[model samples]
Target: MRWRAGVVAALAVAVLLGACGGGEEPVAATASRTPKPLPISTPTSIQQRCFVPVEGGLTTFTGPEGSTMPGAVLGEGADVAVFLHQTSAAGFCGWATYADWVASKDVKAVLVDLCGWGRSACKGGFAADAEAQVRLLVDWAREHGARRVTVVGASMGGAIALGVGQRAGADALVDLSGPAVWQGVPTAGEAAKETTVPLLLAVAPGDRGMDPPALRAAVKAAPAKHKRFVSTRGSHGWDMLNDGALTEPKWSPLAHDVLAWVKGEYRAG
Candidate 1:
């Protein structure tokens, strides 16, 4: 009993000393509380770090698999126009100006960065990842009360859009300089054959790595019911967004055609 009392008194003193910061924490205790090195950045953490609320219409959304996808939402119309970027690595930034124009036309213009491009992250092949991620945004727009959703993509993004628009149930699709085949897949031409939504396929004459005529033919043969193939004069991809001279109207011949065509599609739908 006497030894038990002595042990209890010693333990109480030790506790008090520890509480008052008079005792050093054991090595094991200190190591256990070291905060686990803040686990590697997963999709959620990546979103928190890179995807923040931005000014001037910029926003972030979660991908299908939880990646943080950055984009911009311009205007507040129930009809949504989701713009997917090309493979140039410029991401959503490349589509900003054109998207602004689309927004001004009384539509909700959304410029999106595909997975593994821009600030977005994903763990899969580029084509597949892009398709899934973009679909997430389309579904998001519909869930948020969009009456219609149109996916417009350029180059590689355009190829992916050929398939994504149909799969995501988008009201329409615009493929700018998209190839009939991409990344060893018949992403555009074959997908076009199955497209049930309204479609617009535009290409410049000099754009390489794409068979514009074949693509046009494929689109025309598709059962989309509403489709158009606009032939323009320009370089490729984003270059097709502007006229070479950068004149007053500024928009490329293709851009003008796309705008007019899309406007009609929106009105018809």
Candidate 2:
């Protein structure tokens, strides 16, 4: 009887161990499973606009082709400077830092959205087809009672300004981080040869995109009567946006230099 009771107890213990092991398998499997999280999307219908006040009333105007390109118009009257948008013609935010500098010298500032970007006519991608767009805007500005028009372009837009200056006969042209030779666009060398307007070229030390040596060579080779080159201590478009505000250096000096240049520092016959 003792041997039989011991056998029964041993068998029961083995059965309990087996049941516990089996139960743990399902728990282990469930713990190993994981569900993925859903992806988030950006909103499409967000309007882009930012307002900053200056000495003069806001200069409101549409884009070249009647499209919505809102910009701030500062300065009292007559004296005007048109700030052309870069590759992305969003607002004048790219040149926002220079607003006060521009306004201080009794010069009106017009920051515009280019045709292809922002709230302009051609949305999504660049509108290289609309080469004459800047010319049209310059013409419109002059028509609206602008006495002396100075065109300022950043990066690709700078190249565009050179062309516009030639076509519209602008008083002065400023090119910030503008390439001397654009891949598909007309080069500054080409424009400079034909342009009678005074030109200011602002190049940053960190401008890898622009061939500084070639640009310098081109400037030397060009046939413009008046031309100047300024080298800064940053990357391309530094004077305009300043690497998305990563650094704290003020860019008003660039505007001051350009304004001074525009104010008869360099004049072409």
Candidate 3:
């Protein structure tokens, strides 16, 4: 679209101007002071805004013309929540564990397709700045009445999630196998240290991508009153969500159980 093309031109200059900078943003075409809202089009697939995971689950989310492919929004209910996938898992569908949990609790889910890769790639097929993509999702949530949002991010998505957790005013955050540092972006550990929201940082001892030592350190430093750390046997991220997988896979029920706790399933009236 012409919109993405214009943004590409601006970002090209910005990328050229900054070499050793953080990747935390996007470039959108300028809008008039009073712009008209894009007409909402009937979605090609209800699966985009429906329950259950499916093959090639990517969906289109409009920006200005109601025709852009921003990402997928899942579930449909009162409690608004957002889920971010890992960089490696982009465009893939493995959130059934978390989605099931949310569905059981009657929560509305916004499953952000980690843009810049796979099926979530930007409209112009150019890489979007990581942080900018996150801000876009969070801002969209805000405008759509997603208050007290809960954020769940894994790996690269976890880092970006932390970068905006407090800014998004999330009530709670869950980080699975997220690294303390990545590609010059501010570490989730740093954000953990500063946030007061309830946080649960889970990591497998053998998780190759996530740094256990730094995660433990950050967890210790986090000032959140309800923060907790779980060292489980599952691989990482959604892999840790496996509670009923084969016995030999080094499985753990951390994902399903912790989510139950974070959403206050354990709280008594």
The candidate scoring highest on TM-score is: 1
The C-alpha TM-scores of every prediction are 0.72, 0.67, 0.65
> What ordering of candidates by TM-score runs from best to worst?
1, 2, 3
lDDT of 1 by residue, 1-269 (tens): 99999999999999999898877667568889777666675333222423422225457887544567676687778878888788856567666667667777887888777776887665445435555676788888888888878888888878878866678677888888888787733566678778888888878766766888788788778797788787776677766877533223388656766665555442222
For residue 31, model 2's alpha carbon misses the true position, in angstroms, by 40
Assess each prediction's global lDDT (C-alpha) against the native. 0.71, 0.63, 0.61
Candidate with top lDDT is: 1
Tens-digit lDDT string for candidate 3 (45-77): 324433333322445554432224445555555
44, model 2: CA deviation in Å? 20
For model 2, give the RMSD to the true fold. Answer: 9.8
Worst 10 residues of 3 by lDDT: 49-58
- Global fold similarity of model 1 (TM-score): 0.72
Per-residue error (Å), model 1, residue 4: 65
Superposing every Cα of model 1 onto the true structure, what RMSD results? 9.0
Which of the two, 1 or 2, has more TM-score? 1
**Stronger candidate by TM-score (2 vs 3):** 2
Pairs that collide in candidate 1 are none
